[model samples]
Target chain A: MTTPVLEARQLIKRFGGLVATDNLSMTVNPGELHAVIGPNGAGKTTLIGQLTGAIRPDGGDIFLHGRRITHMPTFRRSRLGLARSFQITSVFSEMTVLENVALAVQAHSGHSFRFWKPALRDPALREAAEQALDFIGLAPRRDEQVGNLSHGEQRQLEMAMALATKPRILLLDEPMAGMSQEETARMVAILGPLKKSVPILLIEHDMDAVFALADRISVLVYGRIIASGSPDAIRINPEVKAAYLGDDDA
Target chain B: MSMNRATAANMVLIALLLALPPLAGLMDGEFYIILVSRALILAIAAVSLNFILGFGGMVSFGQAAFIGIGAYVVGAGTMHAFEDGIEWLGNGYTQLALTVLFSAVAATVIGAISLRTKGVYFIMITLAFGQMLYFVAVGLEIYGGDDGLSLYQRSEMPGLPDLSDDRVLYYFSLGVLLLFLYLSHRVLHSRFGKVLTGCRLNEQRMAALGFPTYRYRLVAFVIAGVMTGIAGFLLANQTDFISPAMMHWTRSGDLIIMIVLGGIGTVFGPVYGALAFLLLEEFLSGIPVTIAGYRIGEYWQLIFGPVLILIILYARGGIYGFLQPRSNGK
Candidate 1:
């Protein structure tokens, strides 16, 4: 079997008395969108944090393309094509949308130690940023200051920034958190074509979007994966239905 | 359009600064030339602080210590020249080179430790480092300890214009200031500046996007330190003396004030800020007014405090903000 693009092996993270991420393992393939859905405090964000190198696991390891990277710094992990969006929209607000994405492109283009040449004039970085923005449908608003963008647009800008890094896999944390119905639909459309090139690990509460996009689904409860299978299989699985869908139905 | 206003204002400022020495000669006297030169030197220091403080969001409160280090290098180097016949130490060119080298080295050592912390802890740690240097300066007995040391002769470069002439010194300092200002402007717009500003705005995001912000911030801190060190070198030349008092924590606080007053983040804000601050200090100190039957000449600080408070309260964008068009003022 081909190696999974990302794999977590027995990850454990404890927060004093409560284990935030219990002994858990998961894998994302190169061309699959794996969705992880759970109720609040289910440790989905913690898992994402661990995957992105923001949070270190107390035990076990994470591998990217079959290489162990459990102890790499966040920036190094990013350079290795592991990119994640913040749960909250986090773009350089004082900068223009193009500038924000350009900075992301600049990160992977080369070392940022070049101090004399103006970055806005860099054709390669600008082209890459523009492509990302165009892909995310934010090309029209490219010149606007990110601070002036709407919340949903800001989230799109965040995706543009992540994409500009040329990630091998995208870890999206609540991309539709504050998005309106139309915005969510737009985001779904924007993300539809991306999975063919770069796999995504989506942690979302919007089950409809998750169900529509995910090739496979994992149900996490109290920091542990209770079930992992095709969305249809998990939808009908007794354990998942009883533990999670039962609550959603009511 | 607003950018044009800012550019035009900057040009006018540069023009005024260029015209100052002759204007001083025509108006006030040699003292005015010295005072304006002092302002230019302090402006250089303030501009350096703005790089980290405004752009990088690193509230370093120890910048004066680097300046102090530069001044002391000159002081100690001069003393060593006279005592041990260290020929290179007496040369102005060599002294400047030594000051830049030593200051960069000091910044590297100091920044490596201080950049480890963030926010208030970062501010406090930098302050602590500044105070540490202050004490070290005070303890140097050979450099006159508390009494400070005076330079009998300013360092001189052969075949170049003498630095001893007040006009020559003023123009030389102005030239250095412009060069640094240009260099800083380039840096602020470069890829390095974007990353630094990105780190300032969202460090976590910058890291997530593959920027090693700590190293960028450390380099920026050192750059600011070296630039301020240049200011310190000029200060030693301007004053012809060196003392531990130059590195006092309050002096660092004053540098912060200059940055804030001018407009913390803007490129030339510190220049405007330094000019306003020094001019106000001169103007206030010269006036003797009776308020409630008490002389307020030496008590100018009492009035200055309230004015600063008023500016902070109403004009959040600062004096430079007030000058720019409202849309892009910030």
Candidate 2:
């Protein structure tokens, strides 16, 4: 078995008395799409926060490629091939779509201390940004301002930016959260091939999308995982049905 | 289309500034040259402030402290030359070097502390630092304390044109202003500038993308301080005096106002703002009207305050936006 590309070992995070993440452990192996599903207020957001270095875990550790990164800064984590898209569609609104993706590309190319040549005009940055946008199917709107893009398109731009970082593992926080059915289908298409290139630890509430795309699904309930297994196995898990999935779905 | 309009206005403004000395001479308005030069020097300060405030989203209220630092560098050097018989301190090279060094040091220290806070706390802490400098200047009795220091001689530029002539000084100020404006243009388009701007738009997002935004903002703050310090160097030479009032908190407020009035983030906005502010001050204060048997000029702020309100209210992006409304969704 290959070493897991990303791992969370007994992670613990507390907000006052509420345990946001409680001894939660998980792993994503090479080229696997691992989806995490849970009901609202089940600590999914908190879990992603810890993975992305936005929240400090109260105890335990996280490792990227078997290297401990629990205490690293968010940017350092990103530099180490971890990229995340916000659940609420965060993009640079004032900048053009291409420029937005180019910034992510710039982050990976080298240090951005080069203070003379325009980043937009740089061939390497532009080509990589364009390729990411093309892959996310936003190539036609690359010149438009991100603020002017439709809600679904902005989410796609977010994906393009995350992809431009060329991450070893991607942490997507509800990339489909406010997207339409057609938009969701479009995103699934993008993610279908994306998982083949980089492993994904997806936190999403869309049940159908989860079952269709997840190689393995982890059911989180009140900060603890009740079960983690193959999508079909998770579907049959009685505890998951009791804690999260309702009787109709079961 | 709006970009072109802004570019045209910038070109016209620069042309007018370039032609001012000769034009003033023809009109026998020699005093106008000095007044415009003072505006140019202050414009440099405004541009520096805009770098952090408008672009980097770091509203530093202590900018006047850097200007004060630069001015005092010259003032102290000249004082030593006349009283202590230390001529080396009076050289332009030494004064310029000291201004850059001291301003960089002061900005680094202040920014390192101030950048730790955000929003109102940042503003207050910067204001506090400015007042700290102001008080320090007030306490120095040997350098005139509250009265201010008078420069017996301007710093001697060994290889450059003499600044003793008022016309030469005015042109010098114009040249420096042009240089800084160009430098700002270059920086705002650079790769580093893209990161700085991204931090301004959404810092958390920038960090998620792997840019250390705090370090970027700190560097921008220091750059602004060093530039404003150079303006302060020119300012002391322009006025032939330096005092605690140079770094007064109100002076910082005035710099922010200038940025807002001209157009906050636009490249030429500060120059437009500085010139407009000084022109307004001169025009409003000299209004020879006696309305209701009361001299209107003495209480010009009554009228001045409303004019600014109107500009801010109607001009969406300040005066530059007024000149060319930003084409939406570019």
- Reference-based lDDT, residue A121, model 2: 89
Q: A1-250 in candidate 1: lDDT tens per residue? A: 8999999999999999999899999999988999999889999999999999999999999999999999999999999999999998888878899999999999999899999999999899889999998888999999887778999999999898899999999999999999999999998987778898999999998888898899999999999999999988988899998878785641
Kindly report the docking quality category of candidate 2: medium
Best by lDDT: 2
Docking class of 1: high
Lowest summed lDDT across 10 adjacent residues in model 1 chain B is found at B321-330
lDDT of 2 by residue, A65-184 (tens): 999999999999999999999998889888899999999999888888777787788999999999999898999999997878999999999999999999989999999988999999
After superposition, the stretches of candidate 2 with alpha carbons farther than 4 Å from their true spots are A248-250, B1-3, B328-330
Itemize residue pairs with steric clashes in candidate 2. Answer: none
lDDT of 2 by residue, B90-155 (tens): 999999999999999999999999999999999999999999999999999988999998889888
Evaluated on CA atoms against the true complex, candidate 1 attains a DockQ of 0.85
Misplaced by over 4 Å in model 1 are A247-250, B1-3, B291-294, B326-330
